[model samples]
Target: MANTTDDTTLALDAVKGEHPTDIFSLDGEGDWSPHITESNLPTKIIWSPTMGFSTVDKDVLAICEEAISELEKAGVEVVVNDSIWEVNPVESWMVFWACARARAQQHLIGTEEYESIDPLLRLFIEMGVTMDGASYASAIDACHHYNYQLEEAFQESPLIITPATCGQPPKLEGDGFVNGEETASWVDFTMGINMTRNPAGVIPVGNLDNNLPVAIQIIGQQRADLDVLKAMKAFEEVINFRERAEDF
Candidate 1:
């Protein structure tokens, strides 16, 4: 959103309204100040080479590997592990997402209002309404279990790194490509983390052969937003991938 980490902190403070009891809310005075710098690098990081998905593009994976090497050279312990989550949380997350949408748009159903909206969103709402109560409850239980798993991982390493996207950026009209095949689920990497509600940030690592930017995700422990930002800042300094308007 901003050109630098300090700018991001300032922008967040500007909109993070005053909420006394909310633990996630920013504390007024010192909270707005930027604490991340070159010296604030993480001691250890967990690097998930893949999200256990076969659709990840080879080019994206290569860039992530190179980034890992750079991080290792910078004196940070990088643990390479393929198994991060015991069970895929994407399915469970989808249930919650669809159900939430259905609840919000329930009144529009069976009316002209529903038919007038976008077809893809209409399909999502339809899926939500048809879901049984047991299924929704099951999804909730799954998410809780997954959160526990993430908490365990965070105990071993304060941060986890993964490719921000499975493949090259998807075109506005279509899905992304992996190994020359179009894959609709290429963007599933972030949804599972979203379910955990852990703090995550992305930093550009390199550019693909097509000149499209590729990035890696840095996920931090729950309520560790500052730690995530610090790691991002450190990685940003090490990688030093700069962008120019003409490159796009």
Candidate 2:
């Protein structure tokens, strides 16, 4: 389910237990790859930066290869390449800022809204979530690009299978979450899907030794939410995925 072009696929390497599974690569299938690398990153990430993280984790790549071997045995076509897919994290940040602004404004003007909202609004204000006009325009362009590309891609391929996260879910350090690369790393796979406004859902595949579960994310095109859910059901049946987290 991982793209050879994306290093996040290496996250699968961290899985514990048996790694038996089918793997296959498709031909000319950058069909699922959405390019989002540091080089082409936005000049200003109103939320945070996407740097300092290694592009390719060798250990993770090795683990991904093993899983692919099993998938190939299952008659899946795995595409092998080193190209990057296009994605802009800023688009989602724009959406986040819009929501934050709406919530903050509601709290300021209305009564009996969510309690302690001022503190949350203050945090976002400090983070530059009230982006500039230029930034908002750029984000709008990015969203259009995403919708166009994703819609076109769906015409060729109805569904895309990918790792749900870069690796095992991390337990929070304390009461709050980390705000930089650490947080970005976890959503590396799902973020692009969010930007594209595609419907994506994850189905459990297996569990790590720490008892954290791993999943395979299934994504469908815009306005195809039902199709995506239907595909998830079919895939779960095909994999015989269970509610319980089983050994890898």
Q: Among these predicted structures, which one has the highest TM-score?
A: 1
Candidate 1 total steric clashes: 0
User: Going through the candidates in order, what is the number of backbone clashes in each?
Assistant: 0, 23
lDDT of 2 by residue, 139-207 (tens): 666766766765554444566555555544556541211222344455565556666667776666555
C-alpha TM-scores of all predictions = 0.89, 0.56
Name model 2 segments beyond 4 Å from true: 1-84, 87-95, 98-122, 173-183, 243-248
Tens-digit per-residue lDDT, 1-248, candidate 1: 76666678778666765588887675555564458787787889888867554357899889988998998998999877667676657789889888988999978989998899888889888899889989988987887787787777777788888999887888787888776778766776877878778888888888988888888999888778778888888888998887854744
Name the top lDDT candidate. 1
